[model samples]
Target chain A: MNIGTRSFQFHTPAVIIDQHTIAGPLEKQGNLTAEIDQFIPDLYDDEKTYELCYTKLIRQTVNILMSRHPLTTYLFTGDLINQSTPTHYGLMETLLVPVTFDHACATFGLSLQSAAFMLQQGQKQTVMVGTMSHFAAVEKQFRFPNEYGQQKPPSSQTTVTGGGFCILATEGEGPKITYATLGRVINAGFKDPYNMGEAMAPACFDTLLCHFQDCQVTPADYDYIITGDLGAVGQAILFDLLVHEGYQVNREQLIDAGCEIFKDHQPVMSGGSGAGCLSLFLLSHGIKHLFKQSLKVLVIATGALHSPVALLQTPIIPTIAHLVVIES
Target chain B: MNNKLFHTVAEKHNPPRPLLKNCVMSFIFGGVICAFGQCISLFYLYFFDFSEETVGDPTVATLILITMLLTGFGVYDKIAQIAGAGTMVPVTGFGNAVIASAIEHKSEGYVLGVGGNIFKLAGSVILFGVFASFVIALIKLILT
Candidate 1:
């Protein structure tokens, strides 16, 4: 389908899903689960109880989406497993057929490959790409560095929960994926986990240039562009770097969903991290009007590919972005 | 009638219509919004058995989401008009503006449409905030 002729329609059912799935794990984990139990005492009852609740939650979410778009095939995005654990992955896999999964190093390549594969297969009319993460699970698995010191960073409080789903149909009723281009991953092979902004710079520049080249669209052609989960510092660095390269984006139109999700009133000092951030924005605000108004939109979902293991060894974090074009 | 006495009588009989209405509406709407927040917090506390700390995150997220949805439905503008900065200054207010602005220009395409419009209301705020903070930091560095 030609980009101009296509009409894109998309829906985002973003809300808490499958809280019960994590319940058993929390109970099994014990220590942190006890701490969480203190806050949500009703959740502490039994290990099996949480599993039941989350299972129901997941079922409810699936049912809701199914009712809304019954024909759409589901795609589970990354961080369906919070810590890259087998159990988390298993739980997510049970909920939906896994098209593909990648963490840290190969996430971008795998995501693009899977997206391309789906587009080619043409088996499903509509594809739903969604992701969810429990902050408790993340905290339990990796003691978010901020929590280590005596004084916790203020941004720790607004930890997000919930899943975001975007329904992509082959019929081109919604925002069309104009270009899902993958830039060659430039591995800095650096090992510092705390400052991901520095490490991911090389990849960010490379991917961005590749995207611009692939679309034959210069930075000026875009009205506004949003990057997924670059946090505060990374965003700052991105803006500076882009300007240095002489491709200045209007600061107004250039938004970071992470920044929007973690408004100043909330204690989320940096910003939200995960697939949910980008998906929610696209569904809630991105597709709804942008598609209707005929405004061209570029939604870039960037991921910092760093595992706890990688962080322990080297601070360098691999990053990837899935760029989709939405036009009215 | 004496001029002073006449003025006093007019003032007593008729206060500004718009001003009075605005004051009343602000109080009622403001109270209602606050009450909703309180209700959500309490609900989390009671039914969900969530602690004060744990309840805050969900409550805040729910409020933001509600505001975002309202902005999507175009109901938030009416609420904002009635409440003025009372509704716009809070985090919920920010969400309302961001979503509403994006929705307002959603036809452009994701990159141009919603992405561009995402900052309609908060654009100035972010700009000024960053500029001011940077200036302040620079000044502090220079002075120290």
Candidate 2:
């Protein structure tokens, strides 16, 4: 699927007609409060275990999306968990063929790109792309057990506890997914897991550059160029990089999902990260603009593909950023 | 192309780490925890009629109990979050680790959840700790 210069221009645009979002309490209080479909006070959505809580979040989101768009082909999903078992096990009731993707925080971008590309290729009439992330579960798996209460530096990001499920189809009246630029694994000797924002910022920059070069469009062309989970630290780095590269995009043009997930008063260190951080934010906030057809949005979802085990062994954090253009 | 692009952007941004600051924070955090334990030991030594050698067991037990209580009360985690690795170096840190494991698995149920998973992280610490001390003593005997 190497379309052109690491980008794909969909012949038949895949439209986002319906979507659902589930956010954590902290996120619910953020700017995107009104747009989020559901927000639980705590991670435990009446489930005994954190894993079950995470699974229930995904199941509930999918249930909502499925209800809205009953006529679908399959489901493309991912989460910040091992094997994506929570999503796999939770979607037992749905008859949609499930395909799980992993690119750390950029799972949603990968899923969305695949869905749109599939629809363009006429592989399936309609598909769902979703992503989920639970802070406790992710903290336990990637860094420390949540209760361990390990000290987090200002560079460290808080993993968002939420999920976003979206529906993409050829027959719809909404923001159309018109372009996609897949990222290549770029290793720049960034080994520290605590500084994940810096680790993925480079990838975000690279993917955005590639998309612009391929589509022959400038940053001003889109209403917002949203990057996934770069947090405050990475967001700063992105701005610096863009400036150094001679890209004169304003602050309004570049928005970060991770930085916006938490309120300014919240003590979330650098910002938010995880599979759901960007997806949930985009589904809730970006979708409204997309539906209005008044804005063309560019989403450059970034992800750190390194696992803790792999990170300890190597100093380089391989990162990816997938690009998707949503036109009104 | 990807490598070049990565190099360009990565070279522009180096992740910041306040190493000196972190080291100091951790030292103070750990130092404060030790100071607390010393105060507890002194309290017991002055109030009770225990010899220096005899005071070790009771002081350690009391310290563990107090820390376990703090962990249960949901105060220790907040302290640990601020203290960094300092909280984990002392006996109370081990106590915190054990309680954390217990709380994490509490949702799984009593038998399968709490009881079974209570030792997940602490089990290895105890196992290697006792074995290492025994090995050290054996080596000391041979050397002496």
Candidate 3:
């Protein structure tokens, strides 16, 4: 049933049957190394290009799931590339009708929600959701080429080079998909690409309020209330805004995937980021935290829905946050 | 008010940006890059037996080639990350930038992807650089 705002309450069960996370060498060195399904030894991974490297990461992840479990009915996925063509073209041979959407980092979250909705309606018995981001490719398209050697400010996040996939079915012996609270684009008048945390923090706060009010739940309800890519600076801004809005999120439970992936000393300025950032962490390290029939999580996957072309005309970066509940 | 709140929060977590640290690192790296070039020129004069006047072109070409290889190997970017402006001032920086663009576009294939897009970042620099130098040299000739 639809809730008070842009949120849903799924009465029937949509459980994750299988999952795979393939991290690049850098992410392997990060804190979540032990939980990752596979550690790619190099950025190229024997491919001629970064795009092909990204495709291989996702393809291998899908292959692992297919080789072990029942085939998912459809595949939903995306990446940070322009038109998401590289990702779509890469997965075309899989023969699964591909659904590609780009809400930036929130692509994974939206994919899961769409898959869960389809499962609830009995239109699809099972669905596979996946996403990937290659650091160099993303650098050329979104910012300057890495070789350009421009100094990005300290607030900027390093887009992770990784991929993750999850297969959810109506019948499974795992965590159940519960609710999805869709977010609205909120701009707080911050205009620096280098300081993206501030640009996206208000949107996170707005979505959190919407989820809390519409779902009639508090922070204590979930075992973990994770933000997609808030990083260090954005999380602090979000925490302050939440307190100002009269909502006290559990400091212990309210963590960010961006901060969790890398170690403290790692040179990742703010934290881990990209479309793969949240999913790789969630599907790998996060799932381990879920004891069967014990843990509940709310993943608020956030995205800054701004293009370089759009930024030239306006000094505003609009942001969105999509939240989904999972109970194990 | 809200802006104040954002700035305050952003400032609180922002580790003091070490301007002096960047300057020192840049100076050291820039010196190292130049010293490497000097050694190459000396090797060309002594070993290759090239004349002092002819050494300029070969030394620069070698520096560019070396930086381009470093760019391909992803070492230049890491150095640039730490060395900052020091890496950008040398001719090696330009070489690294072009090779990086080429590598990023390699997936689109060599024709339209690598060949056409290689200079998208550095094209303007080449254009204005040659143009500006010609104008400055013309003015100098006129003054003389």
Question: Which candidate gets the maximum lDDT versus the true structure?
Answer: 3
Instruction: Give lDDT tens digits, candidate 1, residues A1-328.
Output: 2122111222221211211112223222232222121122332123232223323333444455656676655555555344434224334534455454654322322343345446546666655555544443443334421111111222222223333445555554545554444544445553444444434444555566666765566778776777666566556666665665678677776776556644455435456555444554444445443455656656566666666766667755566555555454
DockQ, per model, reads 0.01, 0.44, 0.45
Sorted into a CAPRI-style docking class, model 1 comes out as incorrect
Q: Model 3's DockQ?
A: 0.45
Q: Which ten residues in a row have the lowest lDDT in candidate 2 chain A?
A: A285-294
lDDT of 2 by residue, A12-130 (tens): 99888888899888787777888888888887778877898898998888888788778775898888788998898789888777889878888888899989878988877789988
Instruction: Please list the C-alpha lDDT of all candidates, in the order they appear.
Output: 0.51, 0.82, 0.83
lDDT of 1: 0.51
TM-score of each: 0.53, 0.88, 0.90
Candidate 3 local lDDT, residue A69: 58
Candidate ranking (TM-score, best to worst) = 3, 2, 1
Q: Going through the candidates in order, what fraction of the true interface contacts does each contain? A: 0.00, 0.49, 0.51
Off by over 4 Å in 1: A1-59, A80-95, A104-113, A144-159, A188-192, B1-144
Clash statistics: count for each candidate: 40, 0, 1
lDDT of 1 at A102: 56
* Superior candidate under TM-score, 2 versus 3: 3
